[model samples]
Target: MTVQEFIEFKIISFGDYFVTPLHIMQMVILIIVSWTIILISKQVVQRQINSGRFDKGRGKALFQILNYSIIVLTIIAGLDMVGVKITLLLAGSAALLVGVGLGLQQVFNDIVSGILLLFEGTVTVGDIIELNNIVGKVEKISIRTSKIETRDGIVIIVPNSKLVSDNVINWSHNRSVTRFRIKVGVAYGSDVSLVMKLLSDSALEHPEVVRTPEPKARFIDFGESSLDFELLFYSKRMFDIEFVRSDIRVKIDQKFRENNITIPFPQRDLHFKTSDTFSIDKTK
Candidate 1:
């Protein structure tokens, strides 16, 4: 039943002061208003779920709005039922608002920032996000906070205000490609050109690595007894980035070994001198 109809039925049954015609009119209007709000909220939720246009951020905002609307409508309905004047409450609380404002500034900021984030399309649920050096996929966005699921399968709840104020990295925002640089050090005498070719072919052979960009092999620098070569390549966005990095290292080592590219070992040359007295006597 509509809120108005339900209230009318209750009033007739109760035989209270609300039984009067004026009271009946007010009750019916209040119920209708609340029902209208409920119906609209339902439609909004369904439409958002179907549309799939807004990212998780906007979707979450809409969901929160619907919840808040329903709550406000219920409050208004209850006040009307109990004969409390909302207008008077608004008037009497005018001075108190400033005091409450000072106390709840952070809360207000969170709510406002949550709304702004929804509209700005910064970080959305299902989008991989990196903020404050923590990498995770957004799981949920709420009024006061947001949830993120990291690769280690941990869930983190971060305040909404912090989300807006911090730098957010949306990994999957537009491009699903990620680049990683793997450094390989081979013996100084190793054929640098041959090493480059081997590394390139190894990267290309990997299914996850991109061939169009054509993994690049460049001489980075000279290390202690070895020459360092860097293999830069793009890969299909993998949730397990560390896995990709480790796998690339393993592949590079295997390839260098098979091709005889002399993966160098650290060596430091040392020259030892005789005691100072023996050296001085020999010089004399």
Candidate 2:
């Protein structure tokens, strides 16, 4: 072969053998770096959220933007290494892409709604939330979905669209204290005023109950045959709700026994009509 042709062949071979693998290695490194930044940023954001130091929405949104930006840059860098011009590729598919965009409307909605959720600061990591019947702590909020770890140790992934479209119960959104109501029934003849005093006192004595707002006992009504009293108190957290209610109930029972108040068991009266000719057939 001619000298120039031989040199050209060598250069082409060198480009394919060395340059390509080097590019792959570089892309791998870039991806690793981007992922590392995303993770670190998440931890930092979570710390700020749990500490109540800043608006959770703002912090999360900032981190999300940072994460996506880094990821996109990594992707673009990889594409550039392969000599695929992104601008030209996008321009070529601009029209067809518009059609695809219509099909992915829900996908875009979920992403946009997720951003709004983070920016609104209505929910945050470590916050207790009930979404689509999934109750748990906000573990991770991604662009399309947010993850929750329930009290029973189950992790759930709910689409951001669900959060936006449905009703969400955030127990620790504005404050840490969550209110729980206990309904108790007493015999109709029981003294109403005394029941109130007993319940309010019982709640105040419990350590889990909040004191500033003051424990409340409201006479809901005289149902079917008993006087219903509703006890309302703010618990330190929803996770402690069961323990608080159980303890308060024990306290109330004790107080009622001492004060001569009875928590009536539901009673139903029944009657039977029978003919005298009817008899049991034991032999059969």
Candidate 3:
């Protein structure tokens, strides 16, 4: 046989569909072309991100959308090249898809949630979020899940649906800075004015604290053992807020010591009552 005839000779058949050397070559070429297109698209998206045309979170979402689109299109094209008609395949598997969909409802929900998160811009990569009392920074967002890195450097995989359905506090959303309060209690007899001044001064002394708004001290409540006070401050270090608070606390303690202010601990006095008949038992 001629080279052309050899290349075209069918090796296997499924119904009317035949697999041939020529067909295999065509499939290989199609895959290469699709991969090249995907790479080019990725490069363009990366350029946009690096150029500051889009913020990191938005850029990441866009890249994910583009990447998924390319993959889906590639799959469709690959099937078509292999002589499988997309419409016919879908029509034949319609019932099977329904059954699978029913079993994978949660999977579909996560995929939908991921799309919503990307489009709505509510939760995105690089955001500091609090969910179910777990506070972490979003590291990656995918079609079904997201990766969050906690303060201890532990990475947790969270379902996209959870992020969407649950109450999530996005600390870094729409603002670069957030307000945090540090609570401190001083002894009841301590000078209130001096305590307030010290709290304010300690916050101001911290480099991360914002200067414009100015930290203010509030006497929030009267406690049982000590006077409850809260120091409100704004800072840009959302992820490192715990450190900022600790530093301020240390400074506050040092200042209080210098000023002879005492932070009192909880104290309670217990009294014993003796009955008339039991009072004489002490002599025994």
Best by lDDT: 3
lDDT per residue for candidate 2 within 1-284, as digits (tens), equals 77554433432244434334455566788888888988998998889878988666557767877778788888898778766778988999999999988999999999988877776766666688887676788888888998988878888888888877899998887786888889999987898999999999999998878897889999998788689999999878685477788999999999999988888878888898986796889999
Candidate 1 structure quality by residue, lDDT tens digits, 76-173: 77666656678987899988998998999999999888777666667666778888998888888877788888989999988888888888877777
Q: Each candidate: what lDDT?
A: 0.76, 0.81, 0.91
Once fitted onto the true fold, the runs of candidate 1 whose alpha carbons sit more than 4 angstroms away are 1-88, 271-284
User: What TM-scores do the predictions have?
Assistant: 0.71, 0.74, 0.89
Write model 3 residue lDDT over 84-153, tens digit each, in one string. Answer: 9999999999999999999999999999999999888899889999999989999999999999999889
lDDT of 2 at 253: 96
Can you list the residue pairs that collide in candidate 1? 4-31
Ranking of candidates on lDDT, top first: 3, 2, 1
Candidate 3 backbone overlaps, count = 0
